[model samples]
Each structure stands twice: as structure tokens, then as C-alpha cells.
Target: MARDGSVLGMIEATEFLDIPTTTLADLLGREQVMDIGIRPLWGPVPRIAGPAFTVRCPPGDNLMLHAAIHRAEPGSVVVVESGDLDYALAGGNVCAVAQRRGIAGFVADGLIRDLAEVRDLRFPVYARGIIPIPGTKAAVAPLGEPVRCGGVTVAPGDIVVADEEGVVTVPAAHRTDTLTAARTKLAKEATETLDDWEAAHRSRIDEILARGGFRG
Candidate 1:
């Protein structure tokens, strides 16, 4: 979902650092959560939260993603819609530059190279996997535009929260409401004791099972 420039800037300033993607996942619909294939390349990757700076890279060409690292603002998650995974979209130096520039991390639907260097830098990267071969830097695509990555349509400035669990994108238009709801959920969960949770869980499961007429 798109928002006005003024609101987009405001939303970008709001970070979900303490809120896990799991919490957001619960609050957001299934469509907002990325598929399992898009996972952290290296862990324990610290949770990253920021607005997305979207990019689209044509198959076998990564010029746009390379261009994005330089253009994206600090604390922005560079989300990419890679055309294919046969060639890597980025390498160690590219990740290094992005890290040096204070970019939050990368979420790519394709692949990347230089795992060792990225792991050493502790730069969070959630992608399909790694490849030895790198793609050419020839394709030109718009930066900061809406792109499809990991089965989710990510618009520029959408809030991206990612960690070991997974990646979830909160729409820019719903950022305020989602953040409020997530915080409320977390706070309530914190107050609930494990015993209380177990009791409630047991009761809920038993009710469902009874309705299903389970004999066991």
C-alpha cells in the first residue's frame, strides 16, 4: 500500500526493533508474511526493522540492486525482486558497502554470493541462498518502487521486520495501527504466566477437539 511522501517519511522513522517478526506475523495476515524460502543467510542475525527501499533486478542482471545500495537511505531494508536465482544478485563488497552506509539489511527473492564475508560483517541478509556466480550489472530498473519479493508485494516505505523467525512487511498505510496492535499483544503476553498460558491453551484445544468429536 502506498502513502504520501510526508506520511512515508514519518513511517520510516518508526522502527519495530523490539517487536519480533513473529509478533507482526500474528497481527498481519498471511499475505504479509514472506515464504519460508526467504530465510536468514547467517545467524544469529539480529532483528532488523525499517522502511523498505524496493528494487527490481531483471534476470541475470543486478544493476538496479547495485545502484540501490548507494541510493537507499540509512536504516532502510533493501528489498529486491530478483528475476531469477541462476546468478547471484550481490557479493561481499556490495554487502560491505551497504553495511558501511548504515543500511539495515537485504531481503532478496533471489540469491547472493560472499557468504563468509557477509557472515563476518554480521550484516543481515534474507534470501533464497548463495551462488558462486554473480549476475551482470546491465539491467536498469526503478529503485524504491513496489516490487514482489518472497511472495509479498512490498512497496517503498513499507515497514520490514526480519529476524531468525522470518520476514514480515507491514503496509505503510497500516503501520500505525499494526504497531499499536503488536505492542498491545506483546504487553499482554508479557503479563501472562506460563502456567496461565498452558491452562488456556489446553482448554482451547480440548474445546476444539470435543467439537470435532474426537474419541482419543
Candidate 2:
């Protein structure tokens, strides 16, 4: 599939955005869901869905990520694998440029700086945390390569759907199947009332309890 979201198509990307990461997590399981550590830098962050533009940054050097902001195509989510968290991977201006260039958002396995500026810009950033010191732009690495971020192995062109709840990566090969399943599940859920859900939930819990011979 094209990394530019052409082969995958922007229409599919828009569909992925309609489904929250939580719904994807339920379908893809924990393996596809990013860890809790990588969360939105600010609350009420708008959901972002796009193809993964993977980048690998060595410890104490964020050259690849810095380079990605300029090169990543519009609507691509820049996913980064930072070697360490001691130094920040990106800051305000870099994020600004990315947003200006029409990049969807960022998902980094390390830290970032200038949280206030990023928040003000309303740019979506999911990372470990924020720091004051920035990493050097020295080390070099390839772009669009597979990267391990937040315990999830993100590959280029994978559908990355992220919001305040969490980040979920839908494998490129299974994008269609995943989206279909997710939409089906959501449609079923939409018709279910809370009362109906509670009754089913209670019955399932009671059955499990009975099977375990729990007397409470």
C-alpha cells in the first residue's frame, strides 16, 4: 500500500477516524493497542486517523523525527521509536511545522517539550511525557521503517487511529477486515440499551461465578 494514503485511500482513513481507538482495541486486542504511557499531551484532544509514517530516533538524537516533520505527507501520523526517554524528541516549532504541513498527529515512544505550545496549537501528540531538555539533531536513520512505540510495532502505511482514550494501530494488511468488524460491533452496540447490557453483563458474571463455585 502507498505510504501517501493513496492506495489505502483517504476515505478509508476517514472511516477509521469515525471509530474510536477503544472500539479498535476491542477488535484488535491488546497487542495492537498502544500502552497507557503514551497518552495525549492535553485533554479533549481531537481524534486523528492516518497512515503511519514511522521514524527511529537514537538515544540523545532526534534527527530522524525532526526530519520527518518536513517530509511526512499530509494526513500521515508520525510514529517514532526513541531509544531513550532522557531527552525530548520534539518541541513547539517542530510540531507547528508538522501541523502547518497537514500532518495528522504524532505518536512517540519518548518524551517531548513545550507542552503549552503544542496544546495551544491544538495539535495531537501522544508521548511518555514532557521534558525541558531537547535531544540533539545528530544521529541519522531511515524513515517509514517499522518502529516500536508504546509496546506496539507500528509499520508504515498502517492505519493509526488515536484519540484521548488511546492509540490503536490497525495492521495495513487487515485494514479492511478490521474496519468492517469494528463497524459491525459498533452498530450492534448502538442498538443495545444500557438496561439490556446490564442484564447480559450480570448474567455472564453470575455464570462465571457459579462455574468457579464462589459463594458470596
Candidate 3:
């Protein structure tokens, strides 16, 4: 946990956010990503939310991510970019290392493999999809640069909230504001909005609330 009593890892943060990122995404009017694969052995794809730290890696390369790992800060999630390359930006070994480093999780615009291990370790990871074939087999990327993931522009130190609903970036400069706004939005949701909508328009709301339900 953080010195302030805030939980530092993915699991701890979940209780504070109350709702998972996927659920939050739905609440925020985002679409469900059916394509985001899962680790069959690990059950459902885990959802995680926390402050973010973004990284840009060359397509088919993760050397920069390795470098980023060395520089990672606790309570931070490393968001990487691969232009939807469907490449293996990260997997078991890398995630294992990241866990040891005290990082929260990982978000990638590309692809990943080694399904069971990542989840078994309980380290959250978000990505466009997965592929067992791995990546293009190259390495020439730079670290701490801007990256485009899931149709969003991201930079280093940006905040990232990810879940079954998909991945969303919280720009670095707006980190504090974003967290505050999201928390307020969530607070209002739990108290009144989430249930009201479910009661008001049972039919229409049900369709929109298809996956699970959005509080706000």
C-alpha cells in the first residue's frame, strides 16, 4: 500500500474505485470490446484502474518497455503502443518482472500471449487482443515517447483506466483533475444515478445496460 494508506497494486485499487474499469467504461458511454481476448485458464479478463505512465515502443519491439520498467514508479501502469500491430508487446516474463518492480499493470495497443500466467499472478493487463504467434521479431524502439493506443493519443505519465469496457487515457497534466472528477462521478452514481436509471426506463436502459450495468 502507499504510505498514505492508498493501495498500491491493482487489487487494492479495485476496492477504492468500487467498480471495475470495464464497468466504468460502460458508465462513461464506451463500447464493450468483444475482441479483447482472455486467458482461458484464468477465467474472465481482469479489470484494473489506477494512475498511468505511458510508453511508446517501436512496432514489433519492446526494448523501450524494458527500459521503461527500470524507470517505472510504484502505483503506475505502463501503457505501451504498437499501432495495433497484433504483436507480443508483453507476456509472462515481462509481466513477472513488472510485478516485482511494484508497477500496477500494463496496457498495450498491440497484442499479447502467455494468457494464464499474467492473470495467475493477478497483475492487471489490458490490450487490444492476443496472439500466440508473438511479434515481428525485432527490437529498435525508443522509450518515454508518445504512443497511440485504442484510438487515443497517450504520453508518458498519463493516467490510464482500463477494464472489460476497454482502455482510456488520463492525460498526465490532468491526472489530479481526472481522478477527482471520476471519483465525484462515481460517488454520484452509486448514491442515486445508477439505480434510478435502472428503475426509470427498464426496457431502454436494460439494452444499454446489456453487459452488466453502468452506475454513472
Position 99, candidate 2: lDDT: 97
- In candidate 3, the residue pairs with backbone N, CA or C atoms under 3 Å apart (3 or more residues apart, or in different chains) clash, namely 22-165
Model 2 Cα lDDT, one tens digit per residue, 1-216: 365455355557777878988899988999999999999999899999988889999889999999999888788899999847799999999999999999999999999999999999999999999999999988877887899999999988888999989999999889999999999999999999999999999999999999999978
**Could you tell me the TM-score of candidate 3?**
0.67
For every candidate in turn, the CA RMSD to the true structure comes to 2.3, 1.5, 7.5
> Which regions of candidate 3 are displaced past 4 Å?
1-16, 19-47, 84-86, 134-140, 193-216
Write model 3 residue lDDT over 1-216, tens digit each, in one string.
133432343333444344555444544333222234321224365555555566776666666676676767666778776664556777788888888988877877667778778878877777656667555434665655676666666665555666555565545455455456667777776788756867777977777877576765
Instruction: Look at candidate 1 and tell me the lDDT of residue 77.
Output: 90
| Greater-lDDT candidate between 2 and 3 | 2
Question: Which has the greatest lDDT?
Answer: 2
Q: How many residue pairs clash in each candidate?
A: 0, 0, 1
For each candidate, give its TM-score against the true structure.
0.93, 0.95, 0.67
> Where does candidate 3 have its weakest 10-residue lDDT segment?
32-41
Q: After superposition, how far is residue 98 of candidate 1 from its true place, in Å?
A: 0.7
Candidate topping TM-score: 2
Ranking by TM-score: 2, 1, 3
